[model samples]
Target: MRTLNVSISDIEYNKFGLKGEQLTFTDFVDMVSKELTRQKLNKCLQLADKYSLSKITMEEITNEVKAVRQDAKNRN
Candidate 1:
């Protein structure tokens, strides 16, 4: 196992009670990584909603919809 030293904000460390505690650094990193991934997924969903493309599928349906939209725009 390798050792890593990190510095976190006082509020965050106090909120999680990680200051001068017995928790392993690996555990802290894992927790932060999971939260980051969750946040990223939420952002992706928000963007999809903004573009009105949330109900898309990978088969012929989504492809046909995209092609039609492009064709309509190109004609104008």
Candidate 2:
């Protein structure tokens, strides 16, 4: 097992609502992972909107995905 150290100002820590809270390393890692995933998803959504892909319907997306999968399976 290893230990990690982090420093946060009192004001900033409380501002982020972490004051008096206890979090294990695992919890910290999970929080960081979730935040990263959220950021990536938001970026992808922004890109989709920028490229006008946001107008695509769910059924169209699903069919396109299925077609690609079937094509790949046939190649194998």
Candidate 3:
């Protein structure tokens, strides 16, 4: 594995120390990535919920749009 040497603030170092020896940089990065993904997903869900679109599946949305386009073509 490649090693990276970057400077971190004293506060950041102390905060990481609180995680103890069991937590390696890889573990920390994995944990942070998961947390960031979760937060982004939650924000997307919140926006969808606000728009009353949370109840609809992605497939349903795709189908609905396709149906509308087909209907428009049929009218023309």
Candidate 4:
């Protein structure tokens, strides 16, 4: 494990809406990861709205997953 001094601007801090609060290394990492995920999700939302993206149900996916697992088991 290691630690290093890093700097962040107030604008970037406010962009994440997390200011003037105590945060550990893991907390900072979690915050950054969630922010990145949120940005990617927003882009996906934009594309979905533009093209009217299709969605799949859990039951539909479950059958595919079962088939894949069975195939892998047969391979073993």
Candidate 5:
């Protein structure tokens, strides 16, 4: 979800069973994160296909939030 990386030099480069493949723990985590995102997106797409839902634009969402904040300010 966030672009954060860790470097632990004490661990051997090929500590993972993938010998000859120079992949670090951070690299492995990043690869898994990408795969998880892809799988989640695919699942959401499948669910969307099975159901009908209304979608709102980013601008519409932002405007609604702004309106709510303004109303709250007025109430106070």
Candidate 6:
């Protein structure tokens, strides 16, 4: 329900696929939010791969989660 005036370079405009496209404020916000989420997920995946966490077994991961939860519960 508000208006914001943002400026971007020609390259960025095209990269966002907004060149010659008419998008509503909500649509633009949604697009940008999705892109941000995707980037964060990709970064996490890269770090997990780098640390060899990507190959972690489900049982090990579950046990780790349970231990963390128990530790948090004890703190509370």
Question: Could you report the Cα RMSD, in angstroms, for every candidate shown?
Answer: 7.0, 2.6, 6.0, 4.2, 9.8, 2.5
Model 6 C-alpha lDDT per residue in residues 1-76, reported as the tens digit of each score: 6767778888888778785646688888898998899999999999999999999999999999999999999999
Question: lDDT by residue for model 2 over 1-76, one digit each (tens)?
Answer: 6777778789857654674556788878886787789889999999999999999999999999999999999999
lDDT tens readout by residue for model 4, 19-76: 5656679988998899899999999888867875536467867988999999999999
Best by lDDT: 6
Winner on TM-score (4 vs 5): 4
Between prediction 1 and prediction 5, which has the larger TM-score? 1
**lDDT (Cα atoms) of all candidates against the true structure:** 0.80, 0.84, 0.79, 0.81, 0.68, 0.89
Candidate topping TM-score? 2
lDDT of 4 at 41: 95
Candidate 1 residue lDDT tens string, 1-76: 7766677788878766565744687788887888799889999999989997687777767789889999999999
Worst 10-residue lDDT window for candidate 5 reads: 12-21
Which structure is stronger by TM-score: 5 or 6? 6
Task: List residue ranges in candidate 5 displaced over 4 A.
Answer: 1-20, 54-76
- Can you tell me which runs of candidate 1 are displaced by over 4 Å? 1-20, 60-76
lDDT of 4 at 39: 92
On TM-score, who's better, 4 or 6?
6
Error of 3 at 67 (Å): 7.3
Worst 10 residues of 6 by lDDT: 14-23
Ranking by lDDT: 6, 2, 4, 1, 3, 5
* Regions more than 4 Å wrong, model 2: 9-16
Of the two candidates 1 and 4, the one with more favorable TM-score, higher being better, is 4
* Residue ranges of candidate 3 with Cα displaced over 4 Å: 1-22, 57-59, 64-76
List of clashing residue pairs for candidate 1? none
Reference-based TM-score, model 2: 0.75
10 residues in a row with least lDDT, candidate 3: 15-24
**Which residue pairs in candidate 3 collide?**
none
